[model samples]
Target: MTTATTDLAASRFALARQVADAVLFEGYVLYPYRASAAKNRMRWQFGVLVPPAWGPDHGEPSCQRTELVMEPRGGAEVAVELRFLHACRRTVEEARADGTFADVAALHLPDRVLVPWDEGTEERVEMSIPVAELEAGEVCLPFTRPAREETEPVPGTDGRTVGRLVRRTERVDGVVRLRADPLDLPYRALKLTAVVENTGDWTPPPEGAGREAALARSLVAAHLLLGLSAGSFLSMTDPPEWARAVVGSCTNRHTWPVLAGEDGRADVVLSSPIILEDHPRIAPESAGAMYDATEIDEILALRTAALTEEEKREARGTDARAAAVVDLADTMPPEIMERLHGAVRALREITEPGAQPVQGRDGPGLPGEEALFRPDTPWWDPEHTDPAAPHGDRVLVGGTPVGPGSRVVLRPGLRRTDAQDLFLQGRTALVEAVLRDVDGGVHLAVTVDGDPGADIRRAQGRFLYFQPDELAPLEEA
Candidate 1:
C-alpha cells in the first residue's frame, strides 16, 4: 500500500481503538473509585463470557456472536480481534516479626496506600484470514492465557521487606471461529459470522454464586473489533433499504455490531457487548476515563473531586486506572472543566423575516421564519416554536389520538430497560405532553392518575416519560 493509504488506515485504526477502549472499560470502575465502595464490589456486569459449565444459571453468558453483512471485493480478507479483560486477584500481606505474613486488605506504606483488589489485565487475540478461506469452511483460532503469580515486596524504613503484594491469574482459554456465506441479493455481498466462546476448562460455581466467582474463570468485557482489508461492511442498526431485510436476517447473540472508525466509513465494525450507535466517538473534552459511560463527564469529575483525601488515597490504591482518574479530576484546568459542562454542535441564525414557520411532526409550529427554531428562545423552551412542538403534538395510540390531557394506560414495552417500569404497567396516566428525541422518536410524558404525589409532580413539571407505543389510550377519559 502507498504511504498515504497506510497512514489513513493507521489513523482509522487509532480512532476505532478510542471508541473500543470506552466500551472495554465502560463499567470497570464506578464513581467513588474506592475498592471499599459497595457498588465497586459488584462489578464486571457487562460483556462477560463465563465458562460453559457456568451458563445462564447465574445469568452469565459463555459465548458471544456477531453477524454482519460485508460487500467483499474478490479475494478480500478480514482481520478480527477479540479484546477483553483478564481478572487477576491481588492480595496485600503484612510481614510479622516471626517471619510469617498475614493477608491484609490494605497496607499503608510511607508514600502510598496499598489495597487488595481484582485488577484487569487487558488481553487481546487477533487473526486475519482470506475471504476464500472463510467462505470455504469455518476457521477456528484457539487462544490461551496461562496461569501465573507474581509478588512485589514492600520495603520498610530500614530497607527490609515489611509487606508484599501477590497477584495471581488463572488459566484462561477461548476460541474465535469465522465463516462467510455468499448472498444472492441484488448486490454482491457476503454474510459473515464470528463466534467467541470461553472454552476454558473449569468447574462451574455453585448455585447462587455471586458474579465474582464466575468472573474469575470468565472473559470479562469481551468484544470484537473487526476490520475489512477491502470492501465495506453494512451497518446492522441502519442499513440501506435494499439491505434492510438482509440486516434483519442477520443474528447477533450477546453483542451489538455498529460501524466504527471514521464517520460514514464501514471499513471497521465494533461488536460491543453494550449497544452503541454507529461511529461512536469519545468526547474531545473528556479528560480521562471514569468507567461509568452513562454519566456526564463534568458530573463525574465533580464527584471525584469531592472525594476526601483518605478516600482519594484508597481509590489510588484500588488500581492504577483509578489513580489516573483521581489525578485527572484533581488537576483538570478550569477551561477544560467548563467545556465539559456544555457543548453546542450546531447553531443557525435567522436571516429572513418573512420565512415560514417550522413544520412539526404532529402539526404546524409557531411561525416567524422559514425554520421553526427561534434565535431568541432556547431550543428546549416549552412555549417556543421548534421542529417538534411537544405540548402541541398528539400521537396515535391504538387508533386513538392521544395528546396533552389525554388519559392512557401505561404498558411499558421491551424498550424500557429499567425494572421499575413493571410497576407502571396497567396504571392510568394523564399525558402531559409528547416529547421527541434527537433521533425523531416520540415519547409520551405522563403523570400517573390517582396517585397522591402526582399533583405535586405535575406542579414541578416532572413526569415519567415512555415511548408512545408503550401506552394505550383510555376510551372514556
Candidate 2:
C-alpha cells in the first residue's frame, strides 16, 4: 500500500531524487521497489519515470518483466549482468521518413543513425528495451536464453525430488520524445526503468525509507557527473513558454548550444545524436521536459537536514565514481575532448559539405575553443603532430604525394581522389583555400621521395595511431 509519495520529506527520498536526477539527467526520476519474483533470486526493482512530460510526446511507460539468475554474493550486493542487442522496434529510416508515422523498418546497428528533424513537428516515440542496453550505448534486445544456473538445486530426501524451481527477473522499459521535425534536426528526451526481482526472499527497501535512500544516492551520483547542483536537473521548472520558444528558435540552428534563460540555468534541447548513440535503450520520448531547478535545490536542502555525517561521506565517495563515467563532456581529458570535437566536425563535414569550418575565435569548440584545429596547422598533418614532416610522417590518409620538384597544383573541382592523394602523401597541394576547405583537399609540399597518390590515399584515416615505420605501406596503395 506504500507509494513514493508517502515520504516526500524524508531525507532518503530527497537524496535518491537528487542522485537519480543527476545520473539520469533532468525530467527523469528513478523509482525503486522491494518485491518477490518467481524463484530464489534476490533483486531490487528500480526505474526512471518521465512523469507527465512524456505523456503525449511518448506515452505511458509499458511494463515488462525479464528474469536473470545471479551468483549469490551477499544480502547487501549482488552481481546481475545483462547484455542487450537490437531491442528497439523502430529504425532511423522509420523515424526520419515521417516524424509522425512509423514508416521505416527496424534497424539494429552498432551505432544509432543521426535522425534529422524539422521545425514545428512534435515527435513522440515509446519503445521497450532492456536497461542493460541503455547503459551499453546500443539498442540491445534480449537473448533467447533462460537464466543461467549458478548453484544446483538443493537435494531432496529422495536424492532427487522435483528440482526446486527458482526464477530471477529483470526488465527495463524506456520512452523518448523527439521534438521538432525529426527529419531535419531532432531533439530527444529519454526515460528508463529497470526492475529486478527474486522469486524467493525479496525484501523491498522500506517504502519511505528505501525509496528515499535510493533516490538520494542516484541524485548525488548525477550531481557529481554534471558539476551542477541537483536542482539544475529539472528543465521544466521554467515556464513552458520559454522552452517552446527556445526549441522553436534553435530548430534551424546547426549547433544548438545548451542555453540558459530566465530559469537561471543552462539547458540544451535533448537533440544530441550522442545520447541516442550512447543510450540506445532510452526511448526518445522518455527524455522528459525541463523540471524546476528550485525543486532540486529544495530536495538537496531536505537531504542535508536528514543525513548523518558518516552517511554523507559514504555518499560523496560513491557519487565521485559514478560521475566519472556518466557525466559526458563535463568529465573528459583535453585529448579526448579534441577527438570528440574532431569526430563531430568530420560528421558535419561529410553531411553538410558546404558548411564552413569555424576559424580563429569564431570557431565553435569545447569551452576554451582549444579543441578546434587551426587552419595554419596544415590540413595534411595530423592535428596532434607537427606539419613539417613528409617522409617520416605518420599521417594515415589513403593518397600519395608528388615529389617536391613535381608541380601539383590543385584548384576547386579536382577529383576527391587527387585531393586525397596529396593528403595521404603528407604533402600540401594548392587546394581551394576557402574557409570550409581548411580540412578539405590540399596540395602536398612534395619532397623528392614522396610516395605515389595511390599509396598516400590508402593511408589516410584509421582508428589507431601508426608509427613512422608503417609509412612504407603507402607504397603498395
Candidate 3:
C-alpha cells in the first residue's frame, strides 16, 4: 500500500480475511480442523461505505457483513456430545481435567495436559422462565467454558502419555427465545458480540495467543471506525487530530458525527465527549453503542476511502501554491531580486529551503532600472548556467552556486554594501543567526561574515530563505 493509506484500514482488511477463513472450517468450537463431510462450509458477505470527511483521492466508503453457517458431522447427530476421558494418571483434580483440548483445556494445564470443551447442538429444551417476571436487567446471558485444558489418551495408548484422567460428559443444547421485553421499554442502543468456536482438531494458539489475537482485532476495528469518521467530517483545523479526539470520546450510546468543510466536502467524525456533552446532535446524550468486530471493520473501511479522496484533493492545492510562489518571486525588481537571491543563497548554506521557488530573468536592463542594472553582467545575458551552482532551493553568486544546507548570516539592514541598493530597495539581507517559526514552516541557523552570535531578529532583519519552487531558470519561462 502507498504511504497515504491509513494504517487502520490495512489492519481491518487483514483481520477480516482471517475471520472469514476461520469460520469456514467445520466443528467451529470443538474440532475446527476436522470436517464432518455432511456439514456445510461457512461464508461471509461484506460491503463498504465512505464517510463525509474523506475526499475523492482516498476512495468511496462502504460496510461489509459476513454471516456464519455451522454444519454438523454426519450420523444424524441429535445431541451435543462433550466427551472427556482420562488417558493418563494424575492427582485427583489434575486427572479430572483433560489436557487434550486446545484453548479451552490449556488454561488448567499451564504445563501439563488439560482439556475443556463445550458442545452446542440444534436441540430444544423446556424452561420455566416466567413471561412477566423477566425485568429489563433481571435475566442475563452468560456462557462459560473450562478455564484450563483436559488430558486425553494418545491414539494407541493403553494408558496415557500426557497427563491424568479427566471426567467428561454431554451437554444439552439450550435455545433461548424472548417473548417480549418484560419492561416493555425500547432498547436504548444496539449491542453486538462475537461467538468463536475452537475446534480441537487444529492446532490451538500458543497459550494466550487467542486472546491476544482477539484484542488485536478489536484495535484494528477501532482504527477503521476512525478512518470512516475522517471521510465524513471536514474541519478547517487539524482534521485528523479532531477526528481522533472525537472518536476517542465515543461511548456505547452515541452516534458518529458528520463534519462538513468550506470546500463543500464532508467527512464523518466519531462522536466525541465534546459533541455528546456540548452539542444537541445524536440522541441519548451518550455514546453507549456496541459493534461487532466485523461491523467496526466495515465502517472504518468506508471512512478510510473518504479520507483518501479528501487528501488527494488537498495535495493538489499544495502543489499549485508552490508553483504560484515561484511565479511571484520571479516578478520582483532586479535590485530587490538580487538581494533576495543573494540573501536566500546565504540562508540555504545554513538550512534546507522550505519550498523550491523557481527563478527567472527579465532583460539585462529594463527602462529606468539602471540603479539595479549592470552593463557588464547583462541581467538577461548573465553567464551562470553550471549545474554545479546551487539550482533549486540554492543561490548562484560570483559564479558559484550556494545550497541551503550551509550556514550563513545576514548583516542587519543590508549591512554589506556590495551594492547598497541591494538592501535599500526594500530587500532583506542574509546574516548569521537562528530563525524559528512556531505555527509552521522551517527553521534555520546560519553563519555570516560579521556577527559571531546574533540572537534577536525579525522578518525585516533577514532575508527569506527560498526552496526549489522559490527560484527558476535564469531566462526560461
- Which prediction has the highest TM-score against the true structure? 1
- Which is superior by TM-score, 1 or 3? 1
Model 2, span 15-69: residue lDDT tens: 3223233323322211110011121021112221211222223432222222111
Clashes counted in candidate 1 amount to 2
lDDT of 1 by residue, 1-477 (tens): 111223434455678889889888988989899888998988888899998876757667899999999998876768777899999999999999999899986898654588889999999887778888989999998889998999998898899998999999988889988999988799999999999999987875454565666687789999988888889999886688899898899999999999999876899989999998888888888888889988999999999999888888888888889999999999999999998998644232322255434434324322221221233344566755574556474666666778898989998864344789888889999899887544344677899988899889989978899876677888862
What C-alpha lDDT do the candidate models reach, one value each?
0.81, 0.24, 0.24
In model 1, the Cα lDDT at residue 86 comes to 95
Expressed as tens digits, the lDDT of each residue in 384-464 for candidate 3 is 332122223333322334344443323322222345334423222342232322111223233232333433434335434
Better of 1 and 3 by lDDT: 1
Candidate 3 TM-score versus the reference: 0.18
What's model 2's TM-score?
0.18
Q: Identify the candidate with maximal lDDT.
A: 1
Better of 1 and 2 by TM-score: 1
Residue ranges of candidate 3 with Cα displaced over 4 Å = 1-217, 224-385, 388-477
